[model samples]
Target chain A: MKLMRLLCWIMVFCIDVHVKAEETHKEKCDFNRGNCVILAEDGRRVFRSDEILVMLAPRALLEIRNENTVQLVKGDFYIETEQPVKLQTPYAKIWCEGECKGLFSRTAVTLEVKSLDGNWRITRAGEKTVYVVPAGLQVSIGEVAENGQAQMEFPQSLPWVPTIKQWASLYPGKVSEFKPELEKFRQVWREAVEAVSVLHQTVATRAVASHEAEVEQARRQRLAQLREDQGLRNLFRDKNP
Target chain B: MPLILYMRLTSFLCFILVMMLGWMQLYSRAREIFNGTSEIKAEIGHLKSTTAHERIAMALEREQFLEFRQNVATLMPDVLKSKGLGEEGYPYRSLASSISRSEAELVRQTIAKTLFERAKDNFRQEKFPKAIHGFHQIIDHFGFTPYVADSYFLLAESHFKQNELEACTGVIQEMVELFPHHELTGFALVRLGRIYQVQNRNEEAIEIFKTVMRSFPQRDVAAQAKASLKGIDL
Candidate 1:
């Protein structure tokens, strides 16, 4: 009898260990947002979009149309997946088929695949038409996305980030009374005041102008409805340049 | 008689031991079920709370961005027309450059502010090209000025108003990324989504709206995004 009781206790112990192991192996992602840091063997992905359906099981499947390689929905995503992260839309399927980092966005006319530091793929849905978008390059799919034009729009934008960095150099540290000859300090404070007061005055004037423009627009609409409208000619009063 | 009683007592003891063992197994199974259910429930509660928190924060951020834009729109004219400090005039940096270094800094600020306001006013009055030029001046020459963020946004807005969708997309993307965590970022993201919708890229629009709903679930923008999603065919 004692031997049988001991055997039953051992069985329960084994079952509990198996259950705990299963919980750890199965990846069940939380559907709610609050500083979610997606961790994989290789790297991490921080989500900033409002609507994303991320499933970690069976290869981290995001929402995509099953009928085609193309996705029915497209939102901005920054991915650094351990394996390749594939994005399917109705028009095309984009994947960092290579190991790397990238940000993908879709617009009204195009699926813009911006490979920040990796080689991404753009394959047309229902067809094997593929475009290899290399590192530091952008590829678009749609009416505006031509075969060769993607390479021409290089050095894509102004130095917005660098510009902010340079601006930060002007920041003056906290000034104490002992630090009297702080010319830069005084200067920073002065400009801040000037900015506030001048901006306030500008906003007030704009409000008044906006109100006046609205009244004028309404009056013009009334007149146009009564007579034969000449359109562009009516809105334009040519002034001396 | 004593031998018969001994056998019966032994059998009764064996039955009691078996029943106790069976009860232990049942209790263990019940405990496991109860623990697993509670764990799942705790997770669900955490997720619901987190989503609610995200929604409230997003709403507040969006409201703040709108308020700032409206005030700045009205303030543009006032800044442009402000008379320089009577004789302590800081018109262009050219005059201040000849003076002390500190004076030059003041002149630069004044000039950048003046240029930004003029460009913004031109935007309000529907003068797209000139507005673009003025905004670029603030970005190029006075990158350090407080006007940089506003200039970037207005520059994109000017392009958008001019029907330069391509340029608008790029600039708004730049704004959203370079100024992450700023209130303007929310507007930029939403505007980007709308641009996609207008261009008939409903799938992309849906994706954007979904992201907004997930990240800022409690916001009116999220609700608007839901409406947008429903309004779209898919």
Candidate 2:
């Protein structure tokens, strides 16, 4: 037992020493979550939690051991290092992993979709499949693909999830008298949906009517051509007599 | 004699071990130096490639500009004379055409840059209308540039500035729609919270702020957003 304890202490001491050594050479670059950026380093920047995104810069290594989800919106990025990263999420669609280096070169396009089930899959639609972001691992979707297959880049997590009562308290009048306000909102939404549907139908009807009119005009022109031909024949006969 | 020999052998072994350790350290240091040199070389190569491309592009632009200037100079006198007002009409017409074309191109580029600068200035000054106009001009005129995303964000900000809550929200919604993967996504979210705050929608503001803090804690704006969220009633 004494030997084992001593070995454990030595291990801890060695780890501390290694950490200090690493810190001596480590430099940090500032970045925002959910925003694409160029990482100005060779080594991968480690993301510490599932609630945050570590915007991977161009050619910068992204090391995510465990994260809830990673959203990729636009830009060209690569995960070229040999590090095993884990993803834990449901319904994620950003393509960011595997032996492939995802190259998204479109000006404004998406590259992947993320599921909530801890799966990060390739999603560049109608473009070369550059990277198959590894399954069950966090990914950085910075590449812009021509196709809009990239899942919406959402922040890894919401900072605070308020309870129903707490949410109600945030707004002075809206949440306090919640039921009526909700009903009113529902009524407004329904009206908006109905209005939009009606507008669409009206446009469709107009288009159909215009097409029918065009067809009718073509028929009338053909009939007029036939009548003109017959009139010329009759006039020729009278001239001959 | 045996005892002395044993002592000497022990001392020699110790020296050899120390020397081996020193040599290993030196080898590691040299390896590190080699790796750093290679990295620097790669960076320099990349920079050189980029510089070469930039130089070529600049040369092409300069050539085009010079050609246009010469054509206009040659045509101006002819047009004035042809006008029968003691001026060369043909040369002037040709000159005017060439100058007009160049001026049009210049205006397009200038308008884009001007809009970008104006938006930034208006944002700083809190002059929402001018900022919105500038951003709209960029979007309308320079949709092909990468600055279109920026214009969308700026337009959203303008709507927010005018106290058009729904309009601002709608514009931001469009921005997110158009450029879901843009670098300014986080900035747009931050602006959304600020708009909510102005309208006394403290809860919504707090929610958005919290989202920024939790999702983008590393962002510069996130730091301010986080601090603001803490002060909210929620």
Model 1, total clashes: 24
Best by DockQ: 1
Candidate 1 positional error at A33, Å:
79
Candidate 2 structure quality by residue, lDDT tens digits, B38-139: 578789999986885565455435434543443344344444555725344544444444444443455567668777987889888998888887887788
Off by over 4 Å in 1: A1-241, B1-85, B88-99, B213-230
> Quick one: RMSD of model 1?
29.5
CA-only RMSD, every prediction: 29.5, 33.8
Candidate 1 lDDT tens digits, B39-73: 78788999986885575456445433433433333
- Candidate 2 ranges beyond 4 A from true positions: A1-241, B1-107, B119-127, B197-203, B214-218
Candidate 2 on A87-128: residue-level lDDT in tens?
211112343232322222111222332111222344332233
What do the candidate models score in CA lDDT, each in turn?
0.55, 0.51
